[model samples]
Target: MSKRLFTTQIKLLESNPNIEHVSERAISYKPEFKLHAVQAYKSGRAPMQIFLEAGFSCYR
Candidate 1:
């Protein structure tokens, strides 16, 4: 996705009260890895596995 769309989506999520701690640090993910992270989240998998599968070098 384009940077504009990504930022807009993040902004929309941040505005929702249900989305607590919706900061950059929490939402930040490389574009190339975002799809994997999203899939993991949808599958109710562990965060660590999600991050790793998403190709995040450092997940902690």
Candidate 2:
């Protein structure tokens, strides 16, 4: 099977405050976002919920 490429719309993430950097293979989120995600997870928030709240999407 072919490897799935990271082809999400980079422009949409470029303006997100939670995002520190966007590259062809990965996304770098800000430290604050990392903390927030962890806290949210501990608080029982779903992973998808945390991502959506931080302006991230799983769809391509």
Candidate 3:
């Protein structure tokens, strides 16, 4: 993902009341997964949509 969009998403996540917290530690271990999420979003997929897909795949 481009730095601009990634920064935007992070800011959105951080500001969302529903998100609770956007901590580095929570997401740090899955850098590759996060990258995939970002790329998916950049490629036209919705971030939340890709996130759910990736999150489920990670558990399985």
Candidate 4:
């Protein structure tokens, strides 16, 4: 089964600059953001830290 995002989560994600698009069940991040995330990961940054730095929340 696939999990879908709540309305509030969608709104929050939409407000982030790194997000290109957001829907109830899908979030599309920008290409530049993807590259940055990869680089950050290779540099030993934590996954959660990368997401937080990109304006994403951990709330569920």
Candidate 5:
């Protein structure tokens, strides 16, 4: 991901209530998986939507 978008996503993740409630163990995305998520987020999708559309269990 580009640095700008990556930073934005980090901020979004940090602020999101879903991430705040979930444990680290629930967020086990792989390297390529992360690339896909970032790609999705960069394409006008919300940071939260990437996780939801990708079926990450931590998203709940």
Candidate 6:
């Protein structure tokens, strides 16, 4: 995904407490969360896999 799209998606996931699809525009994220997710990915998890395991739903 493009940087813009990827950023928007990450923001949506951070803002939502439940697993749901986000159709809106860019969303916001806490700095701590962004750090955690990056750390998780660095610790041997696939990028998408980490988010999926964290309970964020992915839609096509």
Q: Write the per-residue lDDT of candidate 4 for residues 22-59, one digit (tens) a residue.
A: 87878899999999999999999999999998878785
Say which candidate scores most in TM-score: 4
Candidate 6 minimal-lDDT segment of 10 residues: 18-27
Q: Please identify model 1 stretches exceeding 4 Å from their true place.
A: 1-28, 54-60
* lDDT agreement of model 6 with the native: 0.61
lDDT of 5 by residue, 1-60 (tens): 222333324544545443432233333345676787778878899877777665533522
Go through the candidates in order and give the clash count of each: 0, 0, 0, 0, 0, 0
Top-down TM-score ranking: 4, 2, 6, 5, 3, 1
Per-residue lDDT over 1-60 for candidate 1, one digit per residue giving the tens place of the 0 to 100 score: 323333435665554433443454356434545565577688898877764554433422
Per-model RMSD to reference: 11.8, 2.5, 10.6, 1.4, 10.1, 5.9
Per-residue lDDT, model 4, residue 59, is: 59
Model 1 lDDT, full chain set: 0.52
Q: How many clashes in candidate 3?
A: 0
Between prediction 3 and prediction 4, which has the larger TM-score? 4
RMSD of 1: 11.8
Q: Assess every candidate by TM-score.
A: 0.34, 0.80, 0.41, 0.83, 0.44, 0.52
Which parts of model 6 have CA positions greater than 4 angstroms off? 1-15, 18-23
Q: After superposition, how far is residue 51 of candidate 6 from its true place, in Å?
A: 0.8
- The candidate maximizing lDDT is 4
Clashes of 4: 0
Candidate 3: 10-residue stretch with minimal lDDT: 1-10
| Candidate 1 residue 40 C-alpha distance from true site, Å | 1.3
- Estimate, for each residue in 1-60, the C-alpha lDDT of model 6 and write its tens digit: 434455446555656654333445444545665777899888888878866766667743
User: Which scores higher on TM-score, 1 or 2?
Assistant: 2
